[model samples]
Target: MDCCTPSAGRPSTPVAAPPPGSGDHRIEQVSVPAQTFAMGDAHGDGAPGDGEQPVHDVRVPAFTIDATSVTVADFRSFVTATGYRTDAEQYGWSAVFHLALTDPDQVIGQMQGTPWWLGVEGADWAHPGGPSDVAADDHPAVHVSWNDAQAYCAWAGRRLPSEAEWECAARAGLPSRRYPWGDELPAAGHALNIWQGSFPAVNTAADGFVTTAPVRTFQPNGYGLWQPVGNVWEWVADWFSPAYYAAAPVEDPQGPPDGTARVIRGGSYLCHDSYCNRYRNAARSSNTPDSSTGNTGFRTASRKS
Candidate 1:
């Protein structure tokens, strides 16, 4: 259960920005006001088709996200004020996660149904695992695409939270809460940074991390947000439909106007609970908005706070 990677094998287009406000890469956001919750998987514990389930409703009107997940020094200050080139650095390669491969000879191929996902070739987002493995200025920037998080939300004027404003700021309005701190599993030890041991074969970092962990590592969700589920897999702006919750749209439902994958919400650091429990808060998954992987990453949104 490699959480995700490998899709849209090339050209999904849309990654040419600069000049929308162009460069502040702001972070700590929050707001999330306009109510209406119960969006999906009211604990039937989804995953078949993964529309999450019939537990519909939704709403989402206030918006303002990004209380975390976008680091690597806020995407290296938007690639140092937009030199910006990442569709896995223009598809030279990405997807590297054979246990975050430090360099087993920079292997440039894998993913025939997730062979622990190892494409490589200088694995992007500032060399994730190939090429001497850099990247980790406070983690959570991984390989970056959904068209490079819409060119870093069009250079940080911000935009990207719309899986019902990312599950109403990851269920902070807490009701069908499998977690954003609700159903159980946090007496303050592993609030997130998933996968304990035995994933692609023995991680045991317990919570300390085996791949991305500091997007503020843990604790913060009653709207303060941080690490909204596991340590990565964010990228939301819709267009993924495992039957888009049958007829989605209780109010703000902006998804599925077209498709070929887009949505992705929490659940990363490889995730486990016997293979991608999807890290919770009515989990979901998708890719190919120009896929990039090392467990994915994104976070930004604002209709103003």
Candidate 2:
């Protein structure tokens, strides 16, 4: 959950440059369109894991994303337009959600393995359940990293989403399907905002959300974008290496040259199936780019003007 961008809390943004190609702001920036798919399908039947195994073919071309993830008023307008200071508020504390202290007068064990995180201190991302909890300035800003999502995409001029353009905009064409608006899962009510009943304990907000869920709630996929897979896990400038996709490069394969972990892409809101199913769409994971969590978060990319 740590990438490389952690300066402390609140203070980011200052790279600006965008605006000129039709000003699609208000955080609904869609686009996509760059054809070609089938990147991996490790055969869990309809492919479930093995880092989305061998199923190659990428291509890529068109760009633009961020229909969601990066909220909290878009990082408080990039820290009121660039003062930048994240990396989980400078790593004073993070990894929260220890089940609000499983009762018994709140102690229920220190948790860490899966009591549902809980490392808390001052926590970060505007104190998500820490520093006495605050967030909801409009969710989606969970302990950011990858260098505070590249300083909020250089102050929203944009950049960050190149694990083949974040898995070709989270496989919104249904090449394999496990999620990304397919393969059923968002039941009970319909789509978006994960972690339903029986998680660290029980949520049962159904899909209305027991946490997060604001940046456009649910439903959008086929290019309209929004949530890509689940709630968070973006950050893909590329650095991970699970055999470097057997030497990558079917086309737009930029990843691995050196590595300590980076690539994250989709899967958040504590992606279930017991523990990290990677929210599908060619599931892949890696961390430590700087490590900041509570269900990681990031988004922003460009260069297709």
Candidate 3:
């Protein structure tokens, strides 16, 4: 099955949010104004199959979104109150980066295309590297599937940001820059967390992180949103389609009506210039909604009711 595919036997009912102010943690939501901005790959030099083509204009209405990704502490609160189990927990395994694995012998299997990803039993959000590896409270929650994120949103009275809204907020009012900061890449360890040296076998950790970092480790974008381009591949509300930009609506496009996989934006700590430079603002990818990895996480958005 595709990486983003939902499990066949999972429950379909939506979980309701808890009573207001019940949870101890709160996500700081930033208000993004209604505006028309250019979206998609403007540089045209991103990695192939990245679907960064046909730059277009998108007008997104005013919305509020989390200023930072949902940290482990935040998700912990949701799970504590709702008693929900992530897809990773239900499946008894989740994809983990080879570097994060403390014991290679524990790996049950490996992803076909990406051998660097090892399927480790018990590797869920709480156990990023399996039972031996516990997640840090301040780190952004990893190994969360899109389905899991939706569940969290439901419990928090929030929703996932649409691809258009995500890109709009990521740009931070900058029209043509390749990243949230600017066109020039920030020196390693200076800005976002991304692959420093070679990918896969060699990660120099120039950004001071081999795995997930604290959610607010880097500087905020112009809009005060943190790490919009790097750290982890964030799950968006839209479904994935390489050709969606070709005929996408100009105003508030949510993405295709349906798709095999859901959209994931921003690159991850594994991103490198040599390969998968999807750290660019317009770059995007997709995976099965049920897929969860150490390099993926998500923020929340709220629309005025």
Candidate 4:
């Protein structure tokens, strides 16, 4: 099933932001130097249909990427300044994890294949679980689409990282490593935010969170990028293509020339080894430009101008 699906109902009213802190409005960026790195699942451990095969080399130019995924406070600031409405707000609803909802009636529908995802009315970035839920300011902003991320990037004078750049930065200069830290998965609550225990049905929250954790909840990678593998699936600036990696350029590939959906990299708090092992460095996925979900978010990137 698709990670994000559409919902039916009205959007929730935007929530007021808490008092701004020094870090709230600032977008922290880490400089990723120009370098060539292998950019796909050469190890063949990723899901079969995930299109992570044919590991290839890619060179990315120097760029600055956000240290963390955009936070709720950051998105809130943008909305407050621009009065921008997300696709979710425009569509009136977005997909929310069933575990996040308190009231069963709030679920408008369930995704056919991924029944764990509930189409929740009044579920937007502000109300992650529907009208009654409020996202913590420090949490990574969820229920954001690629379109929403692009808008935020425009407002912030940045852009989404290209898929190549994203993978390079995620690798953190490590070559052929399963994760940012190394080959071995760190003990829960050590380096990243991801599902523990049974996925879809039971989340042990062994990482100290059942859902989205604070943006800086984990240690930064070698490039100083925070939560590069987990927390939320980040939208990248590339159209999806299963075979694109084979023909992808060695120097600064930008994904397919055109396609229906955009690339989404890394994984999210919902990922687990049993079903969704997408949190690996070379793993990838995609979704429609306008799709939003409680487990998706994005960070910004920019040329070192």
Candidate 5:
């Protein structure tokens, strides 16, 4: 279900590259050497989660990836150049975590169990908090749909990172570790950005900010990539199928041919041990391509020749 598709349930379109000399953006290109890597961890953080076991190998060619998640400034430039409206805007709003919803008017006031997420109107990437809100120019833009991300990437001369490439960069040098840094979770005054205190209602900003920090606010892994394990969950260019990896190709796997959802990597600040602990390096999740939220965004990669 994690592959590309239109909101109407049609097949997704192939992404295009953005025009040259785009403004209001800083692009840092990192080269990825051609190599083979083992994908997945046999041990799923000492749990029995589906699709995480039966560790396997994959081979890839040399390529380049964006050094960080796409920022608000860069997405703004894409909007300026293309004059495009995001899907969330077209849909009228997006899902907002109840705790992040400080404004009463913005809260649609419905619980999906944990009392954390609420469907709010006018909560798209541009208006991250809702209709009355605006995302900081430096923060990574949120509430962007896969289609929106695809359009932005095309207009930015980049493409969404394939799931394989993304996993490799996230793993960095320590392929067997639990996180980009290591197995241990963030301790008092030790690592970079992440959610602190209680979920939504009482955030202490122990790692730094309650909301999304500016990209690279956390320490970079050995690959020089930042915020791979926390902050926001990034959309990858692959369909979501829990059993697909069982039959995935050993060389440059591209996931299932067709599916309902798209793959998302890394965990978000919303991650919690009791609810969802997907913040681990090997963890993954998925949602409809049209689904957008304040905690979701993406990075890009170029195919190796």
Candidate 6:
């Protein structure tokens, strides 16, 4: 509910990633060198409860991460070979943005605060909005839970990047800039696929999309990472804790040992300045690991060899 999806259930157990080498799940990756950097609201202006304050020093080791998020085609290959079922498919429903829905009958219920989200039956990565709304092959695979992403990584011989690694990668050599490109978005600019006009009501589609865009729609960051700041809220391999940074380890800080919800980074297409303005390098959100939504997806990473 924080960033993208409503909580489906409190799943206490973590799903094991499937065995490696079940499919040809390869992706183009870019390397990020080891470095120390400030890992918080560089401008000291972030949401209150979301906790992007007290800019802290953090260091990460060399690692390689996917240049783009895991697309529908990539997930399809994994499912085709492993016959794996996503959490959404297992639960028989997933959260969908109201504007993305084609059939109202597919909606079973809606969240309390965020009425824009509808719990639709038969909604999964394959059928994002509803049974009729087929996902594009190149679009980021939405409706995928954190567990689902981990399973994909298992089959692909990859893993989700830690929150530290994710933020570090998204920074892409622009330390203090809110966006990977620069400090501020140009007037009437289309840097990323985010809500253009008034959120949830009058979207001008000025950014070429009211929903998810294809990977690399905008220019790559300095490290050649694609769409690092916007498009979808990506799942990272870290538990959520607003106070984690206060006492976190400096070098290669993996998040807290345990948490009810996992951290999500890079606000999604639904993000806007009028409402959910979390589309920045340091901005963060979290949801239940089992929760899935239309605007949430993930990329994979590998430790440097």
Predicted structure with the largest TM-score when compared to the true one: 6
Number of colliding residue pairs in model 5: 13
TM-score against truth, every candidate: 0.34, 0.32, 0.92, 0.91, 0.87, 0.96
Q: Write out the backbone clash pairs for model 1.
A: none
Q: Report how far off residue 95 is in candidate 2 (Å).
A: 14
Residue 54 local lDDT, model 1 = 87
- If both were scored by TM-score, which would come out higher, candidate 2 or candidate 4? 4
Candidate 5 off by > 4 Å: 1-25, 46-50, 109-114
Top-lDDT candidate index: 6
**lDDT per residue, candidate 5, 1-305, as tens digits?**
21111122223544334444534446676677777877786456523433666678888787888778888887887887777777777767677766566456866654344346666877877777777777887787888877788877766667788888888888776667778777887557336455666655787777767778888776778777878777888899898777877788888888888887788888777665554667777878887787777788888888766
Instruction: Give per-candidate clash totals.
Output: 0, 22, 5, 0, 13, 0
Each candidate's lDDT (Cα)? Answer: 0.79, 0.66, 0.82, 0.81, 0.72, 0.85
When superposed on Cα atoms, how far off is each prediction in RMSD?
16.5, 16.7, 3.3, 4.7, 4.0, 1.5
The candidate, 1 or 5, that scores higher on lDDT is: 1
lDDT of 4 at 108: 76
User: Weakest 10 consecutive residues, lDDT, candidate 1?
Assistant: 1-10
Ranking by lDDT: 6, 3, 4, 1, 5, 2
* Per-residue lDDT of candidate 3, residues 195-279 (tens digit): 8776678888877888888988979999889998788889999988888889999989999998877898888888777767778
Instruction: Give lDDT: candidate 1, residue 55.
Output: 88
- Alpha carbon lDDT of residue 126, candidate 2? 77
| lDDT of model 1 at position 256 | 80
**Using alpha carbons, what is the TM-score of model 5?**
0.87
lDDT of candidate 1 at residue 271, scale 0 to 100: 79
Worst lDDT window (10 residues) for model 4?
A: 15-24
Ranking by TM-score: 6, 3, 4, 5, 1, 2
